[model samples]
Target: MTRITRRLALGAAAATLAAPALRAQGTAIRIIVPFAPGGSTDAVARLVAPGLTQRLGAPVVVENRSGAAGAIGTDAVAKARPDGLTWLLTFDSHATLAALLPQLPFNPDRDLDPVMLIGGAPYVLACKPDKPFRSITDVVDAARARPDAVSFGSTGNGTIGHLTMVLLQGRTNTRITHLPYRSGGLAVNDTVAGHTDMMIGSAAVVHPHARSGTLRTFAQFGPQRLPALSDLPTVAEAGLAGLEAEAWWGVFAPHGTPQDAVSRMNAALKESLNEERVRATMQEVQQARLVASSPGELATFLAREVAKWGEVVRANNIRAD
Candidate 1:
């Protein structure tokens, strides 16, 4: 082949190879959800994937890598390249993981950079209609009256819901049986089927059943009452000493990822979150409100969460199960 022709072919090949480097939009983006599919974390990632694809002109994929209470997938993202190709969509358990697993491989604070604080939904405690409990006060009274007779179910052993109950028990000097289910659905089903006396879970898990009249929600573990559960009282009003817990969701990138990439991803996330479809799904399916916060804000929120839940875990002697 002629020198000029060979040189032209090589130039074209170089440009093709450099395309992905020059324009990040040319390659696919992978969003790692550190949980199983169908949960709020995975659903939100999948819901926002199309928006990321639209805004960045790149294919966005949501992959569920569930294990070790989300450490496996999260660690994968933490150790990933900072090329903006990998990200983590995690749940509230993220903060507690550090305190629960002292030997955690990656430092959540230093190994991963927050991209966005999607939103949070408060935990709600509910019971079957047949139960004599009418409010948080009634539940407390029942637990006091019969220490181990009043059973409460949660999603898992070390979940925020579980800790919330533990906090309540500690503050109230009550002893209620804790029935940890493998999944929220199972817990909710048992509560509805009268197998369990009561249950604690996120608004996402309990709201629908409450709305459907299968469960009677009494107390919301948040600062204020939710619009949907407006009639329900908050723990503060129940005189629980400001006991509040919310299940939250967020996005993160491997630490040391370029600021430009972080900003770009944050912007795309904001835009996607604003989409009516996304907002509707979050509220209806996940019972989550949209915060759509900046990276700095997310960082601050994450730090507070880690500290708060770490204290809870350590104080209660809770561990991953």
Candidate 2:
């Protein structure tokens, strides 16, 4: 009859009511890829889906809901029930969404919880083989000379590739027009066809053309050069000291999922990254490295990336329009 006793009874009843719902789901998990199939995000998700399915003792399915620059699929995951069954496999660009769009259906920081950071691929600054630019400085000098005439293409606006070029332009105080394509393939194709002056895109996506001499790689966007393209210098080494950016992916679940579930997902992903087949597949694609990080680490990393890209976006006056 006492207040304290009543409060304790209510707490116990709530726990009892919640237990069965949690127990009923067990371990069945779904991983959502925001982009279409065959891209890096899909590839990364498929690579670990089987291992996760085995480790969690449940089937893991990869669902692609590609559209609206990844907003459609990401919003689906954010609005899903926070029971840990639905997870999102996305890239670092998700953080930029909040800054890019005038309005967003979901708050990435509030509606999603970090599960793990999968890995990243460096972006390569490349040009047509016959183009006069041979290095980052060469491109900078050309842009300086031509002003907005030196055009650069990216997968799309707000993509890592777009932002990387923005950062480069900001640092070197040069101007370059932007051509945003729906995919990296399109942008790279245009650049190779001499339709665009340059392109900053994923190494894996651009490496083949560069190797074939159709495209010439001037520099890589990362703290260090990638082994697959060791001859190319890092942007810093190429004379841009602070310009480092890359396409990175991570896993996240809807907010309010149990901490234990997040931990299990992180552990499973980490194990998957260590698998020889996974490593080989990533390397074959020219992905720089597979970094399996803890959930907390991923959360911190997302926060930092958001701030970093926000500065670049604002400074460059980049708007979705």
Candidate 3:
């Protein structure tokens, strides 16, 4: 594998499934986000739940079951009955958790079935507005000057944000103390409250804060600049070549779920994502490009992510906290 070649799995998602099952009618459908509320994962779940409720003729509920870098809640969905009523909406951490927790209770690949690849967004590294940072050079210099004295917060230990910062520190030969939180919102709050020197999170979590002047962004962890953030510099542009990392979100159902149920859920998801408000919110508010993908495509992408990030976890000697 040349640099573990990978790409976002996407396909011409069929707008309508062969047969839309009415199994969920009048039943309360639960969409479980395996992270704390106020984060991107929770946001995406809530955004689509209403539309899903309408489309499926069921009362959709979003639930937060946060802990253990998303493994606890994920494991819940992994072991849930394949009734199509219980689904999981997860973050980038989902792909990397198995690499961190070897004794993870559930087989991420075998226990849960992919429903959709919601989308991906670049990680944004930023500091509080009052911090002394004009560019990535200053941040790097500070970290080099005091090594682990400079601290950065992330959603959790094995989250892509945390690993991305780890990769950044390694590439720059710096040591910043890792401060992992239960969720992205908590991390952002503490960073803004002057509890941490810097923070890195998905565009969905950090973009709004940066725009509001609560935090000052320096480097975007994307290969190129996005339309919404054209003014910001890419990590590569900051002189750290090949330092790209994008946080992704997706939906999944318990393994052994009926094919008809999966197809019906997928169709509802595609329709919910196609809504104009959802499209604009995803692209503008979250700064995340949406990829409402087919189930097969999401499965392929999940496999690729597991392979790629698992290597990073081992190479970095990343242990779960």
Candidate 4:
């Protein structure tokens, strides 16, 4: 081969090899949901994937890597290559796990870059329909009258339901017996069966039971009352003015991912959230409100959540059981 022809061929080979690196769009983007399929996190990832694919002009897919209370999949994202191709879609437990489990493999705050706050739904404190308690005030009065006698069911220790109850007990200065179950369904069932006096769970989980006359929802934990559950007042309106808790979801990329890539991903996320179909799916199916927040806003929110939940975990001596 002639030297000129050989040089040209080599140049072409180099360009071909470098094409993936030179391109702004990744070959594919995988959203790692740290839970099983059909879970809220997984649903959110799938709901947003199509819009993200359209916006970023690349294939987007969801991968479930559930285990160890989300630590396994979350660690996968934390240790993934910082090429902006892999991200995490997780719930509020992401912030509380670190405090509950002392030996996590990855540092949630330092190992992942915040992408967006996504959104969350208020938790509902409901009781058996036969229970006499009419409001949170009634429940508190009963609890104050009989400390540790009034029991509440929660999904598990260190879960949102459990921790929120911890915060409630702290704020109310009441000592209620807590019965942690293996699943939210079990907790709700127990509450409905009247085995437990009350339970604090997500609106999605308790709303149907409440509608069916199995459970009586007293209040929802949010800054304001939920329109669908208009009869149930807000936690603040129920007399705990400063208490606001919810089951939130967010997106995060591996730390040190390029700023431009992060920005592009965030924009795609915002666009996906604004899409009519995505909004309807999230609200109607997942019962989650959409929050299209900037990366900076997500970072701030994550910091606050981590700190706030961490305090609750420590103060209550909560552990993952």
Top candidate, metric lDDT: 3
User: Cα deviation in Å at residue 120, candidate 1?
Assistant: 1.3
Q: Judged by TM-score, which candidate is best?
A: 3
Q: Which stretches of candidate 3 lie over 4 Å from their true place?
A: 1-23
The order by descending TM-score is 3, 1, 2, 4
TM-score of 2: 0.83
- What are the per-residue Cα lDDT tens digits for candidate 3 across 75-96? 8999999988899999988888
**Rank ordering of all candidates by lDDT, starting from the highest:** 3, 1, 4, 2
Model 1 steric clash pairs? none
lDDT of each: 0.85, 0.81, 0.87, 0.82
**On residues 26-78, what C-alpha lDDT tens digit does candidate 1 reach at each position?**
67889998766645566678889999998876899898887666788899999
TM-score per model over all chains: 0.85, 0.83, 0.92, 0.78
Writing each residue's lDDT as its tens digit, candidate 2 over 165-237 gives 8777778899899998765667778999999988888876788788888999988888887887888889888
Q: Residue 126's C-alpha lDDT in candidate 1?
A: 92
User: Across residues 167-270, which tens digit of lDDT does each residue of candidate 4 receive?
Assistant: 88889999999897654567777897899999887776677678778898888888787777877888888678888788888899999998878888888898
Flag the better candidate by lDDT, 1 or 4: 1
| lDDT value, candidate 3, whole model | 0.87
Clashing pairs in 3: none
Number of colliding residue pairs in each model: 0, 0, 0, 0
